[model samples]
Every structure is written in C-alpha cells, then in structure tokens.
Target: MTNHFPLTAKRSLELLGLIAIFGVLYIAKDIIMPVLMAFFISIMLLPIYRFLRKKKVPESLSIILPIILVALFIALIVWFFSNQIGILVKDFPQIKSNVSQHINNLSDWISRITHYNDKEQKAFIQGKSDDLMNMGTKLAGGAALTLSGVFVFIGLLPIYIYLMLFYKDILLRFIFMWFKTDHHPKVKDAIYETESIIKSYLIGLLIQITYMTILLGGILMIIGIKHALLIGVIFAILNLIPYVGALIGNIIGVLLTLTSSQELWPVITVLGVIALVQFLDNNILMPRIVGSKVKINALFAILGVFIGGSVAGVSGMFLALPIIAVLKIIFDRTEMFKQWGVLLGDERPAKSPMGFASFRKKKPVAVKSGTEKEE
Candidate 1:
C-alpha cells in the first residue's frame, strides 16, 4: 500500500505570502534605508530627550535642543571646512612640491631595495603617479557629490528628526498594535530592551571614538607628524568599522608617514603608537563600553559589519551592532523566537535540574563504601 501526505492550499498560500512580503521589501529598499537611518539617529538621541523630560523640560523644548545642537554642530563643521579651503588653496603649489619630493624619495628607496634600475623605477613611479592623481580627482569629485547630497538631505532631516522625536510614542504604539492585546506586555518589554541596547551602543561608540581621536591625535602630534589632525580624524572615523578598521587606519597612516619622510624610525614609532592605542582600545575601553551592550560573538559581529557595509556602506557598519542587539532583544521576548534568542545571545540560560530518578538513571552511579560516584 502507498501512502500520500498531500500539501494543503493553506500551506501553499502561506508560502506565497512570505514570498510576497519579501518582494515588497525588495521593492521598498530605497524608502526603507532613509527611514532606518532616521530611526537609528532618533534612537541614539533618545537618552538626551528623556533626560530633559526628567528635568521637567517640555517635550517640544527637549526635542528642539537636540535638533538645534545637531544643526549647530554641522554648521561648525561646514564653517571650519570653508575657512580651511582658503588656506589650502593658497598653499596648494608648495603642498604639491612637498608631496612630489616625498614621492620621489620613496620611489628611490624602493628602487634601491628591489634592485630596479633608474628607468624601471621611473616607469613604475610614473604609472603610480598617474594613478594617484586620478585617485585624488575621483576623491574630490566624490566629496563634492557627498556634500551636495548632505545639503539636500539637511532640509528634510529637521522635519524627520522632529516627527520621530515628537510622535515616538504613537509610532511605538502602532508597532505594538500588531500583536494580540495579551502580548502587549511582552511587546513593550522587547521594545524597551531594544531601545536600551541601541542607546547604550551609541553612547559607547561616541565615547570610544572621542577617546581614540584624542589618543591618536596626541600621539601623532608628539611624533611631530604633519597632517596629524587629519590622519587622527580619519583613523577615528574608520575605527567605527569594527575589527578591520584599526588595521586599515594603521596601514593608511604608515603609508602617508612613509610618503612624508624617508626616516624609517618615524614610521616605526607611528605604528608602535597605533598598536598601543589599539591594544588599550580592544582590552580596556571596548570591553567597558561597547562589549557589554553588544553581546554578540566576534564572528557574528564581524559578519554583521560586513553585511551592513555591503548594504548601507559606512553608516550600515556603524549601525550593525545595534541592529543585531535589537534582533536579540525581540527574540528574547517572543516565545516562538526563544530558540533564536538562545542562538543570538552570549549568555546561555541555565538548564533546570532533572528529577532525581531520571538523573540517577542517566548517570548510573557506582556505589563504593557507602559513597555514590558517577562512572
């Protein structure tokens, strides 16, 4: 006799529904990116809003303060860049000459070490010189495009931030409304945990970046490195990318240092300083700050960074940990997703003890001199 287990129409429809949902998300990618960005930014700023509210400040005032501060900060950065442009423009010729001289010294050193003749060395350097020039031009163009995009986005940002800050409660209520009324408590708990995780991650990230910037800048300055401020700022920003970021920063710093001076010791000293700072960051600062909040394993954290970077670039990488934390939070609260919670969570929930009979049956202890022991 043959037996058949037929697929029901309901099961077919359920599979179709899942596909449709994913299709919709794929189509809405552009819209989702901006909303996600605004949401994370709001999450990061929520603590300040809560603090103000706790101090008896009006919601409007609390919201307005952070928005204004953000605007002022952007304006300050713009002003600084505008002022620097003039000096940079005036010194461009001298800067180019200095750079060219450094490049020549570096090429000569490489040629001597590699046994490349003058013609071969010059040919190699010329090709690199062209590549460098093209890269600089491309960088400049990209920066211009980014600046333009920022200006366009700036107009929409205030409104977006305000709505997020003001109607946060209503928005949250709408999300919770999807679940059954009895599940509301669990939903709220999940939301709260997720918010706490995002907030903690952002605060920790800010502290880490600021500390890294200061430490890096001071070290570079002490070593009398030119463009120390620029290099430090670059390194600090790159540090946001997680594990590989510091290494990239160091490589860039060393290359730039090599270009600036023929002295090997200066480059070695710079590397040493960066290594020390990285050691401190990884061992002391990261553990105290980010590690607790982002309880994911190193493998998952790295995977998260790569996936985020692939999807949203640098912004995504920076947002990845909090995103994973939020997922873990939700998983922990939802009964159906408890298994996922176990997978994502760093801390394993302790197992309850089995009944004495069951435990003894499984163990099959040996008795010796009135003492029982498991073999």
Candidate 2:
C-alpha cells in the first residue's frame, strides 16, 4: 500500500518553503534585483532582438543596439527632468514665499478651530523643522552609500541583459531539463504566456505613462498651473505603484500646486484634474492596454506590493504584479498548486460557499415552505 503525508504536513512544508524563498530574496536582494530586472527587460526586448536576428543582423550587434536605445531613452528622460528641475529651482524664492503664506493661512485656520495661537503653532513648526533638519543630515551621510549602490545596479544591468539574451537557449534548455519529457509542452506554454504577459504589461505601462504625463501636464499648463509638467512627470512615475501610487500622486499634485502658487483654486483644480485623469486611466486605458490575461485580485496585489517592498524596496514593489503573474501562470499549470493560482486571480464565482450569491450575479434567495430552515 502506498502512503501519503497528511494535509497538515503538506501545508507546513509549503509555508516553510515560502519563508525560505523570501528569506533568501531579502538577504541577497542586491545581487538578485539587477539580474531579475534585466531578465524582465530582456523579455520585453525579445521581439526586437528576434526581429534583428531575422533580418540577418549580427547577434552581438542586435543585443547591443537594444541596450543602447534603452540607454539613450533613459538619458533623454533624465535630461528633460534636469532641465525642468533647474527651472523650478530658479523659482525657489517665490515658492518659499508661497509656502510661508500657506503656513500662515493654515496657522490661522488651526487657531480658529483649536485653542492654539499663532505663536504656539510657529513654535511647533520650528520644533518639527529641527527634527526634519536632523533627519536630513542623517540621510545626507548615507547618500553616498546609496548613490554607489545605484551606480553598481546600473553598471551591471546591461551586461546581465546582454548575457541573458545571448544565453537564452541555454536557459530554456535548463528549464526544460528540470521537468520530465512529458511536461515539456506545459512548460513551453507557461514560458510563452509569461513572455506575452510581461511584454504587454510593460509596454502598456510605457504607453500609460506617456499619455498620463501629457493629459495631466497639458491640462494643468492650460490652466496656468506652475510646474505643471513636473507634477505630471512625478505623478506619472509614482502611479506605477498600483493602488497606493495614485493616492500618493494626488497628494504630491496638491502639494506641488500649493508650493508653487498662493491660490487655493489651483490646489483644488490640481486635485480635480488628477482625480479625473486617474479615473479615465484606471477605467478605460489600463484594462484595454494591459488586458485581463493576468488578473490579480486587489487583496493579494496589495499584499504582494507590501511584501515585495519589504523584501526589495521600490524595485520589488514595482515588480510585484509581473512576478505574481508569472507565479500564477506556473501555479495554474501545475496540479498541486492550481488552487493557489485561483486564489491569486480576480475571477468571481457565481455564489459564495455559504450560499450567498456573488454581487456580480445576484439571485433571489427563495426559501422552501417547510423543510428549509431560515437560519
């Protein structure tokens, strides 16, 4: 007779395995993050790479060309930001005056609402400012270390991308070799699906960023909001962080508006514009562009973002969805982990397990005359 481990044992083993995986990821994040990022970028660039190859371009040249194009694109963005920021910096005195005016306004409002007078509010602000100054000092001390790490990440990224593309076949073979011959088809399907999903998602994000910047910045500029382009760029980038990002973008938009202008209407206008753009982007743009192939429910998506941030900071947070999507693809293909794939998806059932109909599919809860208990 054959014997199997109990369900409890299986669950414990799975839990332990997950803990071990995340532990390793956190410990070796510096080494893993760049490679992971490169892998995704390479996947996104695969079509370009293949097209070059089909045109009889040298493999080395094809790889290098894509990397160079990406570098140029990044440099262009950096230049634009620097130029815009220099203009913003030139208006610092005006911004400071506006900020002070806003602070006085706030103090007056607070004094009217509470018992705190202007002196008390100023004292409180001074104390907090000192605390911030000290915190800034500490951050300045660590800035060099952070800067060096960023350099290292950037330096290693292209090399990793190039090598991954060069050795793509070997990687495929390695993956296929791990599974039995019978499972190769499933593995290939998963690989192809992951590639499709990653490519679509990343490209869609680029498109979304472009339009968001244009829509937000253009509207704000049309309304004569100062630093409109800067606000648009900041929000467009931050909006990549999923649900949490849009909220942060709104806060940032309002703060930028307030800092640059002494008018309350601009602040309100900024908020309204941000809200409208976000609504349109979320409802109309993202769905059609990114598609519903990898539908992660909100609960798990938020948890993934938090867990990823804990494990690998901002890069982790940004990568959370695609990583989860890849995992979901794998899990859905595997019999043992198919339930997990379902858990990660956004599909709604017709009814709940306790007999409550799904909101999406409401049904009349008819009661039998005698046999069925209302309880």
Candidate 3:
C-alpha cells in the first residue's frame, strides 16, 4: 500500500511557501530589482548583440556598444526633460498667479456648497496646508535617500547587463543542467519563447512610448497648453504601469494643465484628448504592436500592480506584468504549475454545468434508437 499526502496539509504548505516567497521579495527587493531589470534589458539587446557578432564585431565590443547606445538614448531623454524643466521654472510667476486664481475659484465654490465663509475656508485650508508642509519636509529627506539609491541602481545596471550578456552561454548551460536530457528540448523551447516574449514586449513598449509622447505632446501644444511636452513625457513613462498607469497619467496631465493655465477649458480639453488617445491606443495600437502574447486578465493585472507596489514601490509595479508573463510561460510549460498558469492567464473558459443556468449553453436534443436524448 502507498501512503498518500493529505490534501489539506499540502495546500497549507503551498500557502506558507507563497507567503515566504513574498517575504523574501520584499526583503531583498533593492538588490533583486536591478538584477531583474538588467536581465530584461540584456534580453532586449540580444538581437543587437547577435547582429554585431555576425558582423565580426569583437565579443566585448558587441556587449559594450549596445550598452553605450542605450545609455546615450537615456541621456538624451534626461537632457530634454532638464531643458524643458529649466524653461518651466522661468514661467513660475505666471503659474503662481494661475494657481492663486484657481484657489480663489475653489474657495467660492466651496462656500456656496458648504455655507462656509471666506474666513472659515481660509482657516481650514491653512490647517491642511500646514500638514502638507510637514509631510513635504519628511518627503524631502526621503527623496535624498531615494536619489542616492537611484544613482547606485543606474551604476550597477549596465554592469549587470554586460555580465549577463557575456555569460549567456553559461546561463544556458546551467538551465539545461537542471533538467533531464529528455526534457532539454522543452527547456530550450521555453527559453526561446521567453526571449521572444521579452523582446516583443519591451520593443513594443519603446514604440508605444515614442508615439504616445509625440501624439499627446503635439496635440497639447496645438491646444496651447504650457509645458505640453513635459506632461507628455510624464504620461508616456507612467503609462507603462498597465491599467493603473493610464489613470495616473490622466490625473497628472490634468494637474499639470490646471497648474499652468488660468482657464478651466484647457483642463477639460486635456481630459478629452487623453481619453481619445487612450481609446485609440487601447483599441488599435496595443493589439497591433504589443499583440496578445501576454493576455493577462484585468483582475490579475490590477492585483499585480497593487501587490508589486506594496512589495517594491514603483519599480515593482513597472516590472510586475513582464514578471507575471515570464512566470506564466514557465508555469504553462511545467506539469506542477499548469494550474497557476491558468489562474494567471486571461483565457476565458467555457461555461460549466456548475455555472449559473442563464450562462450555460442549452444542450442539443437528439434521437438515439427512437429515444430522445440530450447531446
């Protein structure tokens, strides 16, 4: 007779294991995040690396050249933003006047709704402003620490990417070594699929960012919104966060519009333009460019964003979808984790007998041996 494991005990162990994994992620996120980012970047650069190799470029130069190009592209973006920000600073007086006008308008609206006099409104706002000031002071110190960490993250990223690219064969060998010879083909397939997914996803994102920035910035500039390009840049970058990102981008766009302009029409126009652009992007651009290779469900995507944010803040949120996609790839290919892949996936299942009667499809009636039967 064979001894069987109890189902409840197995499930409890699984839950505990999951909790522990999350704990480890939260603890080592600072180190883990950069490495993970580098891994993705290296994968994205594989085509370039291989192309250079085919051209007889030296091994070290192949890796170094891609890194250099990527660095320069990033530097150009930084320079653009810095220049725009400098210009924005020069218009501070106008922005300040607009802000004061908006505040007074808000005060009047609040007075009408709540029957609060100007003095009471001013006092209430003053108290809130004091609290905000205190919070800002705390955030300033935190920002300095965050800024230092960012520098370190940037410094280590290229080194990590270079090493990963350099040791690509060793990594492949190690992965192969983990599995039996018979399973080597499947492992190879999974690796290839994973690389394809990462390459398509990241490259598609780059394309999306460029177009989104141009479309949003150009439209906003046409509408006479101040600092149009800056808003576009912020939105395009933030929009990488899936469903939540687009919403946040819209909020930021509106806030920027409100701060820059004295008129309410620009804010409304910003919203309308963003909505139209988002509609086009979601309905048309995403399907064509990104494809349905990683069809993550809305529920899981939102949950992943929130969970990632809790675990490692903005970086985690940004990395969450691709990580899930990679995990789904592995899970779908592995016997033990296929159920998890199904759970994470966006595939809709056929209605079951256990489902609501209204949702279940009617069975066709058939005659078998002169007897009516449901088929």
Candidate 4:
C-alpha cells in the first residue's frame, strides 16, 4: 500500500530545483546582481513612493523624487569622503615616511626571527619577482573586470529601478495569480512582511553606519590618530557586511594607524576603540533599530556572505543577508517550505520568536563572533 517511490521522486525534484536555482544565480550573476540590487533599493524607497502617491503626485514624479533623494544622499556621502581623502593626500609625504620606517623595522624583525640576512632576503625576493609579475598581470586583468563591472552596475541600476517601480502593480498581480484565491491573505502577509523586513534592515544599517562613524572617528580624533575620520568611515562602511566585515575593518584600521603614526600606542588605542564600539553596536543599537524580524541564524548568515562573495564579489556579499531574509519570509509563509524556513531561522520558540513586536524584547543571543539582536 505504501509507495515510497513517489516520495523519493518528489525529494529528488526538490533537490534538483535547488541546484538549478544556484546554477542560474552563478551563471547569470552579471544581470541578476544589478536587478537584485535595484529591487532592494526600490523596496527601500517604497514608503517614500507611497507617500508621494497619497499626496496625489504624478506617477512619474513619485518614482523620480525618491530616486533623486537616494542619489542626493549618496552624493553627500561621496562629497564628504572626497574632502577627507584630499586631506590625506596633502599629508602623503609624512605618511610615506612613517610607512617606510615601519616597513624597515618589520623587515629587520622578520630577518632576525627567520635567520635570513639582508642579502638572503634580497635573493628570496628576486627569485619570486617573476611569479610576482605574473600575479600582478592577473590582478591587472581583474582590475579591468572590476572597472567594467562598476560601469555596468551604474548604468543598469537606474533603468532596473525605474522598471521595477513602474511595473510594481503588474508584479503584485502576478504574485497574486501564482497562488490560489484562498491563499490570498497569506500571500499578502508575506509581501507586507518582506517589505517591512527589507525597510527595517536597510534603515537600521544606515543608522549603524552613521553612529559607528561618529563614535569610532570621535574616539580616534581624541587619541590624536592621523586619518581618524578616514579610518572610521572605511570601517563603518565595511562593518555593514556583518561577521567577517568587522575583522576586515579591524585589520584595515590597524594598517592605517601603523602607516600614519610612529608610536605604537595609537595602534593599541585603535583596536581598543574598535572593540568597545563593536560591543555597543552589537548589544545596544541593532536590537532597537533592526529588531529580530528576519531571525536568520549565524551559520547561514556568514555562509551566505561568503557564498555571495564567491559568486559575485562585493555586491553579492552586501546583498546576501537581505536576500536570504526575503527568501526566509516567503518560505515561512508557505506550508510545503515552512521547515526550510525554520532551518534558516534561529532556534527559538515554535509559536513566535520574541522580537520588537513582542513588546518584551528577549536578551540578545550569544553568537560565535558577536551578539546580534536583529536578524
């Protein structure tokens, strides 16, 4: 009476479907990445677009206005960083001198430890010069790819965003049509929750970047660190990537401090400042601002970042968490996929995980690298 073949076939199809999805993502990343980025930007701008529509603004104006606002905000950030970079350029000679001194000191220390005299060191480097040249050539090609990718992203982004905004109603109708009439309520809820999660996560990230820049930069300024603002801004932006981003930020901060200053105290101070700031961010700010709406566990979050990076580089990493969150939302709302949602989410209550909506926010969960109150 029990026919196991049907069940096995169903599972096989599901596994194949997942593989095909990933294969497509990898193969068509050039187009997929830009469209995905545009989608997120559109979702983030949805509230502003809706508000303008309510005021009886023209359809085109409502969309154009929000995009312009986003452009202006980005331009402001670019302008500020340009000035900071100019300041650093003016102090370049001093920075170069300090960097050279540190490099010589490091070389000497390495030579002493490894028992490689100056002549041996020179020979070792000379022997590797050919390999280094080949590596440099490869890097140059990669750089070309990167530059072209940037232009493609800039060109396609506005177009994709406009289309997404213009066809928003059509997309909604398609979503509705994909489900039965009886599931309309669930589909609507999934859409609403997805929008809310994307909005909250993005807005929270902006807040996090702002305050991190202030606190981290301000502390470094007080400590007389050169390029304090530069280091702070770089770290703050990179910190948006989650988990591994902080580590990268830390290394960059330390590297900048070492190159800019002769004294070691500034390096120590920079590390300490970063640690304290990260603590404040992880424990205090994220929970209130982002909440726990997405609820993705740490393992998948970090894996998604790395996988996205491997697939599409920086943009992929930036888009990873939010994309995963949106997928989780859809999965959670469907009966056949709810178990996958549970695996994606944190191990918490079956009824409902405590979030900002719960009124009584639960204590932050301890993760391997740091604690995150928000998903």
lDDT of each: 0.73, 0.89, 0.88, 0.86
The stretch of ten residues in a row with the least summed lDDT in candidate 2 is 359-368
Give the TM-scores of the predictions, in the order they appear.
0.77, 0.93, 0.92, 0.88
> What is the TM-score of candidate 3?
0.92
Q: Which stretches of candidate 1 lie over 4 Å from their true place?
A: 1-30, 54-56, 77-115, 131-145, 346-375
Error of 3 at 320 (Å): 0.3
Q: What are the candidates' C-alpha RMSDs? A: 7.4, 5.4, 5.9, 5.9
- Error at 46, model 3, angstroms: 0.3
The list of candidate 2 runs beyond 4 A from truth reads 1-4, 354-375
Q: Is 1 or 2 the stronger prediction by lDDT?
A: 2
* Shift of residue 90 alpha carbon in model 2, Å: 1.0
Sorted by TM-score, highest first, which candidate order results? 2, 3, 4, 1
**Residues 1-95 of candidate 1: C-alpha lDDT, one tens digit per residue:** 12322335544675687478546645664455566767877888888898999999999999989888878977976785576456557766766
**Judged by lDDT, which candidate is best?**
2
Compose the digit string of candidate 4's lDDT tens values, residues 175-210. Answer: 999989999999999899899999999988999999
Q: lDDT rank, highest first?
A: 2, 3, 4, 1
